[model samples]
Target: MTKPNLLPRSSDMASETSAEFSWPPLESNPEVFTEYLYQLGLPSDWFVGEVFGLDDDSLGFVPRPAVAVIVTFESLKKETDAVAAAKVDFFMKQSPKLDYACGVIACIHSVLNSLDSITLVENSILEKYYRATKTQSPADRATTLENMTEFQEVHTSYASLGQSSVPTAEDDVKHHFVTFVQNALGQLIELDGLKKGPVVVNAASSDILKDTAAVIQARIEAGVYSDSLAVLTLAKVADDIDAAVQALIDSSNGVLEVTSVENKDGAKVSRIKCTATGHEMPPRADIVTAHVNSKRFKKATEWYSYDFAQFEPYIVSHRRKPKCLFCNVTGIVLNKIPSEVEKHMQGRKFVRMKEHVKFFDEAEIDKDD
Candidate 1:
């Protein structure tokens, strides 16, 4: 079957007049923005997560210690004063060619500045932009960004909202997207595309997420969104959760290297050693158990009810030869029915296979859906 387009589609905002065109408005979704970042060559370790509502409690949904928060808020007359009164570190103003795309770029710029782990590839478009504008004035930096064709292309492509073709101009909308971040000194900064400089929210704390939310909340209460708070959407740029989990699994691979130290009377003396540190490494069995208990593992087995209906024919055709669902190698026999399969399931090989299957299944499900 031809799978449906799993990509996000933009709302009907085609231009009424043919003379002018604007970039399509992007969805304020973490997954959509995250995938776009990946398309821009961001490493898998980083992603964007959306905060559903502007409520203080809603901040808990996003990963903590987020590199930056992308906030979509209604533009108001007092916005300039509100941001100025707060602690502000404004960046360059948005270029005319990249009007709507700047907020997304500013969010990414915050991540690049705050998070050391979210590094760009060597000689990357982002790297070049960073280096070129690192010492330039905000105006110069903005000019430098406007000329970066590759970066603009990727941003525009994602901004297309999965349309096979898009209009030159989008319906003129009033809402604006801005980025909130706590700099290295622990001061909240707002980066808006429309603004000439970053707005500093006069709040400083180690927990930037909550503090930034409070700032946005304050703005909402005083600005146009005060009446309708749902207009505010937040996305956190942070390290990927799955990648962090996988790193734990990888760290468990501290080799127990054996080396012969000396020979005594033609007998060799050896010792086994592990050189890895930073955290107490779990045993292989514990790692396997963790994998089995993961959500990915549970979801992959949805198609497998263990009624043996799907496997009975395959099992019989192979003459009782049972292959591990995880390992894919067949050595265990299906001679004894469910008991044999159940017994095989406890083995490490099956556990390893389950881990692999879970990863594959999750990827397939994500891609298909």
Candidate 2:
């Protein structure tokens, strides 16, 4: 969608400025478009314009060249009243063409018409009375009697009563108000002759489409309509449903695939996969040991192997050579216990073995003789 170009034009001497301006991006969906129009404060008429010659000194100033269109029933008798006649007045003072004005009016009319249909479905009786009041000319008691009878007939039916169970008095009142607005808008569209053009309704507010989808699904289930249309509509709803499902997923930090197991010994175990590390393990235990001595030895060996495997990547990737700590010697065995090992690590003194060596030599010579 093209954004409104209401920003001031630069006056740099080195640059050239164009006179033509671009239109703002139109809302494609009818439902969203209608809501946007209503949000703009319901203009009696619509207008667009182009502005020029804005400067830094006039910061915060509303330029006269800015487009200002008004859609109002009131005559432009006074300057102030004319400016305030419609809720919408684009910043530029330049007048839009008649065709542009008509197009905007038609778009607004279509949305109002759709809203009217929804209102009728919500409240039939009140909507009928509202339409009569707006469309029919003022009449005597006799003329009103016919309208009164028709209104009663339309409202008093069992179907209408069933549809009118609106939960609360406030809901009924709101429905009546919307119905009245819808009736008024219908008259306006007829008066403006805006019924022929393409009427786009915002898909977001398309309750009719939702209703249609439900009906299609029901018919398909009953073997009436073909599966194709029903499937397509369902697919659309599925997209929306998936979005809702995804919201729940997002709120809870994604879905978890869990596994439960029970051993023959009646022990229960649960496992979960970590998303970050892609590793699966028992939920409660980082390490487990069995009571059997043989099993204990096997478990210890497995634990050592696992530990070594975990460190292998780091060991292989390291750039520097490993050295012994006790004697500051390279290519020596690395061990946790000094008494069970022969080689000492670098950075410490080696044990004195001269006395042991002399005793061992004397014992060997005596044995040989």
User: How many clashes show up per model?
Assistant: 13, 25
- Which ten residues in a row are the worst by lDDT in model 1? 276-285
lDDT of 1 at 27: 56
Off by over 4 Å in 1: 1-24, 80-90, 115-117, 162-167, 226-369
lDDT of each: 0.51, 0.26
Per residue, candidate 2 scores C-alpha lDDT tens digits across 152-201 of 23222311222324232222121000000112212211113212212212
Name the top lDDT candidate.
Answer: 1
Model 1 lDDT tens row, 108-158? 555555545466655665655665666677676666555555655666677
TM-score of each: 0.53, 0.17
Off by over 4 Å in 2: 1-35, 40-98, 115-369
Decoy 1 TM-score against native: 0.53
